[model samples]
Target chain A: MDETILKTEEQDFIEEDICVAENLVYHKPKTLTDTDLHYCPGCGHGVVHRLLMEVVEEMNIQDKVIGVAPVGCAVFAYNYMDIDMQEAAHGRATAVATGIIRVLPDKLVFTYQGDGDLAAIGTAETIHTCNRGENILIVFINNAVYGMTSGQMAPTTLPGMVTTTSPFGRDVKTMGYPLKITDLVAQLPGTYYVTRQAVNNAGNVRKAKKAIQKAFQFLQQRKGTCFIEIVSNCPSNWKMTPVESNKFVEEVMIPNYPLGDLKVPKEEQK
Target chain B: MGELRLMKGNEALAEAAIRSGCDAYFGYPITPQSEVLEYLSREAFNRTGMIVLQAESEVASINMIYGAAGAGKRAMTSSSSPGISLMQEGISYIAAAELPCLIVNVSRGGPGLGTIQPSQGDYFQATKGGGHGDYKLIVLAPSSVQEMADFVRLGFDLADKYRNPVMILADGAIGQMMEKVELFEQLPRGGTYSKPWATTGKTKDRERNIITSLHIDPRQMEKINLRLQKKYKEIQEKEVRYETFKIEDADYILTAFGLGARICKKVVEIGREKGYKLGLIRPITLFPFPFKVYSEIAEKVKGILDVEMNAGQMVEDVKLSVNGKTRVEFYGRMGGIIPTPEEILEYFENKFLKGE
Candidate 1:
């Protein structure tokens, strides 16, 4: 058993290397831990996690920001994000975040949730948390499917889309129209910054990263709830290759769910 | 000792929580227990920096406690039967996560919205794992307004000591009744221990703290279960609490808890007045039940009467403890009914002495 123990280099134990400095233009963010993420190739969860942690690192608030992980595919987000985190029950991330922020109002708090966890089972908590204008950031991942559950129909699944639960193709009339919860929350007075972005491409990734940065900055300013919804893709669950998934995200998903800032605070208010 | 005041059980509990220097309270309005939320709303913030928020629902309130407990804070919530039923999912998560917090159940009649009146119908749900999975909640039954005031501090201490959820199981009778209580002096916030493993954010000196109940591997899950079981076994050994009266020379033993115990005290006196020697045993810690006393006393007593306000709930535990050494009879009311001492004494006499 002792021989079977495979010890790897502990975080930059090989940092004094002679040949590795010049060629590297960018490196992994310090906010991300060394643990391998379990997300599949081309999965948007990994990118979002990276972007969120990158923002946490850039803002120098890595020691102050506490995250709440959701119950969907990102349930193990704490393992990768290298921040103090509490794993929420399915759809209760916002409520859990509320608890943390209320107890220690000085700490920066945020929650990362998927569509099923956020828009479906946790709809009440989400609406009320936003309505209360909880002074925290909310990162919503709308992948249109329950990726962890192998492509079940989520509340954001498009009309006529075929999923495991809606195998015969989702009927908008029977299955209920695909929910645009971001649009609904944007209308609420509690939201200080509400935006929708995608990470299916390089440009989109940069924009999403900026949204995350502003979300944290707004939270630091003690603004009301900062909600950012990301249009993402599921490759394995979508039964498509990584490239095909990205293409599908652009051609099909983007048209259905347009990406832009839905609600922004007034310039004078900031 | 702090100043004494006449207070309702729910109000006393809320006031005690404030004095205990609790960090936050997340609660919802429920009958027989709404005063707890109301009292805290009026007093918690101004007295100390304690946070008081009326959550969206019982489900939200319990998860809020979970979040607060994860961060190593003293947080609590109170609700009645139906609301508690709604909180089962979050309670199960908190239990599995091994987070310490307090939950008060001002119990009422259940089985699908039975009544708003006090009932002990939640015994099986409280003592037995009310939620899913194999978990035992440390249950403290408060019988009076004074105990209600005292148990808030005790519950928080026990929770932090074991890093497990502790529940104060009171009922509508206790929650609504008014009695003079000598409150304890105010303690500092966050209680006795400094939780090093709390998810309070990662600093440069320590690794990140992750508060989660998820263990996808079967072996890891089994190990978590075993750890919880070991902790529970230790609690069973060290935390068994009960109060016994006149057991030195009695032939009959009367077993009850909370209000049942208070009523049984009267029944014991009534029986003693009628030339019958009777004793009473009230279990304070219901989960780490005084199983040894019940089993040992079974040898000396001629019979035991289990009194409750539900359909033979706690009687099952009593019967199991007695294990056929002596007759264990049960007499109780259901659907928010409380039997008088005369009624209980008559039933005992008819069953044991008259052999009816």
Candidate 2:
């Protein structure tokens, strides 16, 4: 049995590509390799991870980038990214990034956060950090549900979406409403660029990579905070298969929270 | 090398932190210690681009320190009693992560919004564990404005030596009162002591380093604790610092720290003039406790008078250090009331001299 497993693992490794291509650019993704990812199958987090690494390699910022890992499902981001990373307390990635950027102003600093981690527990930290006009990039992953803790409703969960806590469908009368962070943060003058994108398909994935690259580039230009909110799918938490999750994201999530650039300064506008 | 200048204790501490080449200052305004923040704010931007941030709250100030220290910068924060209590969680996190930084606590009356007068009620919190955890801060108790200035520099050096958080424990009297002081020369900035372990940026040649206190395995935590204990033991050997006065050939010794020690100094002077052999053991490093010196003195002294602003905190440590080798007694004034040297002398005359 051990011999058979090793043979199949080797075959799978051979099948997996050593490099990735996006927008007519070929880049080597970091060695995510045979280490079984802790993410649930068909989760959007893995796709986001691959896209980010591809950007890191393509822009050749792998050496100059510092990643602030959140305490959500992405807590184990250190295991995937080959670049320098630090794990922050729940919802404190921005505060930690503020410190990092203040000390090493030249380095590119970015934080990866989830809806619950960023919008719920870390709301004050996130808001104050943006308000401070910290020269850092923020890649916010809004999956609308808590994936790691097993199907819990997050602050960005759409209205009427049900979870373990909001079992009978999130009641607008009691649970308030889903949060639109991009729209809220975009109102602040300190923000250099704020955009909301999705990752349900290859085309959206391409757009996300471009947005992330641009955000990093803006930070390199000494512009203010650049935030990219990536609307993502959580199949395991949504209790739907991979394909159904993508369909739900397009048909439900996009309509309530439309995807587009919510804010871009005239100087930063392309 | 120069003439003495009359300065508030808080101002002295500010000058000392600057001279020590401190990289950043993050603080919120509180009474009795507000001048420390004010002085730092004025000079911070001029000298080598020192970062001084007037944070929104005591909570934000300490968290900012956490961030700066994580980047391997020598940062500090100052606050009074109530504000210090609010910073306990951040302090514990800094201690657990073993980050080097300085915290100044100008104590006032406490146990919930007491007077702004001087008080040693924070003795237990400062000497023992103030925050939740099995950890200790390298606490320095300064008796005078001169010591306040001197200890700020020493606190930074000690923190760097042990890679641990250090606290300069003062009170409203030491913080508010003005006294003569001789300032030291400033240390050169842009030295070679850079934290290579800090998470500044990711480069291709290095793997990303993560700074965290979370440990899932119990055994792993135990190993970490043991490592911390070993480091603390080393500190005990090398960093135990104190001052002794009139102790040789004395029949009795006065054990005190901070302002209490200053009052005790006066008591010792007058007690000796009256032909009673009274000495003093003033602990500069409260965490190290100067146990060896006190243990040795126990063999020669008849008893120890543990004087403090609180009812009885350091007396417990004095008693433990004496270990029944000598009789240990205590005298205290609480709730923001400071005891003068004359009152302490009268206590010695009435409590020990008259009784004996």
Candidate 3:
């Protein structure tokens, strides 16, 4: 017991010896709380959460922003995000965000939603809110499967992809083709900026961060609905290791749902 | 009289909402209640800068109310029977989150779009837990255009006082019928109460506040349920309200609510002219129901007649109030049919004083 105590003390001392500054190029933003995330290993939700808060922190608008969390895997996003956050009912985050932004027009607002919450049940709300030109940022995380409920086929699930619901792979002839909701919404005049991004690699992560920053800037300008669809991966649901799942996202997901800006403001046209 | 004017019940309620300093009104177009949305749209926005939005559906409207109320704004929505049915899900969430808001239901007959005519059919859905969990709404049954106007302020106050949703349950007839109403003086927005628990973007001086009803832990969920039950119990003890007509030394009592009670008022006079000692009991607050009055009246009255537009929904509550000490009978007109005062009196005499 004495030796164990000595070893623990020595380990503590060694840990203290290794300072945080040496090669410490990155750290969590203060806009994120101290609560440990309940996300599974290698899930894109953690990175997205970090990057979103980092942008909020960088902009120095943490106190002036409110976020609505959807009723999917990110339902407890309010637990981690250190802002005035509201947890919305299933498929109602966009509508909930609409309410907030309408009441507190000057306060920056955003909603983080998963595909099932946005594209399936909340499609009408999402469409109407965007159509009404509600000035808010909508960060949609489309992983192509319902991660929280265990790999159910989502509205964005790729054709021929096997999910728990689609036991024999998705047949578009019967299950209907995957919806390109962002593509659909980009055509609306209310959408100021609409982009499909990915967080599969270091480079793509940077791009996603930039997109979020631009969206927040647009929100500050009151430039109507800004949507960012992050084509993320759900490793646990996809039945692959984190690396394999990301490789699948890069090779499979991107080819079908192409990344990059689908729409931009009129002044920034071309 | 502060701004006395003759107005329809729907118009009076809308005018009252503006005067009560409501922060936002979100609703959809449904028959018998569309006037609420139209009235607010025509008169509210340009004057008060209040957010008035016509949502896509009752589902959208209620969720919008959830968001606005969660942010500590005085929010509300209005709809008829089918529309209120669609709002039940969001209403449950609002109640669980303990956000103060008002919901007005100018109810129509429904068992799936039964009719666009008047109804008190939603008594059970309004008083009982309408959604998945154990929760309650402070239900106000407005019988007159004046009550329709007056209850808007009272509903908001009760909602703010308890941090729970308050519902104004009216029927199609009351919503359409015009009567004299005195609107309250305008109150400034956000001046009535301080919202310490609102998710209004936490500032430097305060800790962040989260508005959510998702409690993952069973233990924590039970604790929340207990807290809600305690609040409901307190409301029941304090908020019981009833309007009586000639109850002193009466042998028979007539109990009804909303327009049904208005009809019963005349029934009381009709019965008295015929030498029957009759009185009327009108429940003002439906959820914190005037159960005590019925219990006390049961000690002396021979019987009680529960008149309603629905097929005897409130009769169940009337029975519970009397607790079988005295006979509680029901007389109902179904499918949007409004029984006349003479018809109700005849039914009462046939049911109670027959062959006298």
Candidate 4:
């Protein structure tokens, strides 16, 4: 019994040494509230939210930034992020953000929307706000299916991907092609920077954080719409474990989305 | 008078909005009210540095107003009936969020794009919660060009006071017709009003402010509805405004609003000349309805004639106000038709005075 106790004490000492402050590599972003996240376990939304809050904290614009939340899974974003937020009607975030930035021209504004909200109901607002060159940032999360409404077909859903609405697996002939909305938005003259990213792993999460930071900086520069499309995963609705969902995103989603900067300002053209 | 000018009611309202220190104007072109957008587009930017945007559509314009107003900026949008119909959803959200904003509807005839001419067909839609839910817009009916200019400030003030959307309900005739107007002095852009509810930003001094209408919990949403109801009741008690035109010792009353009231004023004078004892009650604020004034006049008058440019929408409110104490009759000219003063007088002679 004493030998067992000594062995346990030695193991605890090793863990304590490894977990010391000097060895700590990461912590929660300052902008994220202390409240536990309401997102599903292993869902990409929490990671995206954390990365966004981290970027906002790193940029030190917490006091000057206003965010518009969409009517989907991220609807409770205001409760999680310690920033002023306007909850927009389905697909009206960009329009609402346009209104805010127009009047309070000194403030930084961004809209966080999902594929269903941005690509379907909010098509007009999304297209026109960008066309008007409103200096705002838009962070789009495309998870192929509607996560909030329990896995319905989305505008960005793969042509043959099955959803509740498409019970028999989406037939391309009937379901039509998945919209490449980011590409379409890049064609508009009002957009200054447009990129597609993901957050499936540590490296991708870092890239997405950098993209969000740049989009916000572009808004400060009075550049037109700065758009970042994040192709994420919906493990719970995808009916797969988080690991399998991550694998699906890597193998299937990336081929369809193809991450990279689709457009950049002339000065940053490369 | 600050400065008397012969201005169309639409242009006068636009000028008044500028002087009221509107921070932004997002509008789309619609007939009979197009002059408002044009005038603001030409004048507001240079005069007050107001943000004037000709939105792609009225849907976009109202949403823009929603955004700007959410940021605590004084914002407005002007549209005719068809455009206003498109704006109903955004207006409902604005009302639900309790954001202060102004909407001026220079109404045209419409069940659907009926005409670009003068009509008060939208009385029901205006006063009785045109948008969904238990929401009420402070509906102000302006009778003349002077009132059009005057109500612009009043609408903004009442909207700010209630933290609700306010509407200036004018018909196409009142919007297009030119008359003398005395413009009010400009209020400062950041006036005395403080908007702590606005989603401006999260300053260090206060917690973050959220502008939202969504309450997933039914009990919580009911509380919001009740709060809105309490505000509407308070407005009804405090902001009931109507002009009594020679109602003392009158045998009958002519109830009308906006351009209909303008015509009814002439009818009252001519009916008096004909020895019919007709008086007019002009509703300045249509939603508050001035129901108490009706009760006060109910004993003096034998009957009431509700005149409108619709097929008798406000007459229902008139009947409810009179409560069958006095006989209530309605005469209307729909599909962009405006009843002449002579026609109204003849109707008063035949319908109420002579009891034919």
lDDT of 1 at B44: 88
lDDT of each: 0.92, 0.84, 0.93, 0.90
Q: Count clashing residue pairs per candidate.
A: 0, 3, 0, 0
Error of 1 at A179 (Å): 0.7
lDDT per residue for candidate 1 within B1-356, as digits (tens), equals 67999999999999999988899999999899999999999998998989999999999999999999998999999999999999998998999999999999999987898899999999988889899999999999999999999999999999999999999999999999999999899899879888998987789999999899999999999999999999999999999999999988999998899999999999999899999899999999999888899999999989888899988988888888889999988888989988899999998888666763
Cα-based lDDT at residue A168, candidate 1: 87
Q: What is the TM-score of each candidate against the true structure?
A: 0.96, 0.89, 0.97, 0.97
Clashing pairs in 2: A63-B202, A63-B203, A84-B208
Q: Which lDDT tens digits does candidate 3 get at residues A1-270?
A: 689999999989877876557946788899999999999899999999999999989999988899999988999999999999999999999899989999999999999999999999999999999999899999999999999999999999999999999989999999999999999999999999999999999999999999999999999999999999999999999999999999999999999889999997778774
Writing each residue's lDDT as its tens digit, candidate 2 over B112-165 gives: 988888888897888788888788899999999999999988898888777799
Task: Please give me the total number of clashing residue pairs in predicted model 2.
Answer: 3
**TM-score, prediction 4:** 0.97
Give the top-scoring candidate (lDDT).
3
Model 2 regions more than 4 Å off = A1-28, A31-36, A145-154, A157-160, A167-176, A236-240, A268-270, B2-4, B351-356
Per-residue lDDT of model 4, residues A193-227, tens digit only: 99999999989999999898888888888888999
lDDT-wise, the better of 3 and 4 is 3
Model 4 misses residue B338 by how many Å?
Answer: 0.6
lDDT of 3 by residue, B1-356 (tens): 69889999999999999989999999999989888899999988887888899998889999999999988999999999999999999999999999999999999887898999998899999999778789999999999999999999999999999999999999999999999887889898754789998888879899899999999999999999999999999999999999999999789899999999999999999889999899999999998998999999999988888899988888998898899898888888888899999998888777556732
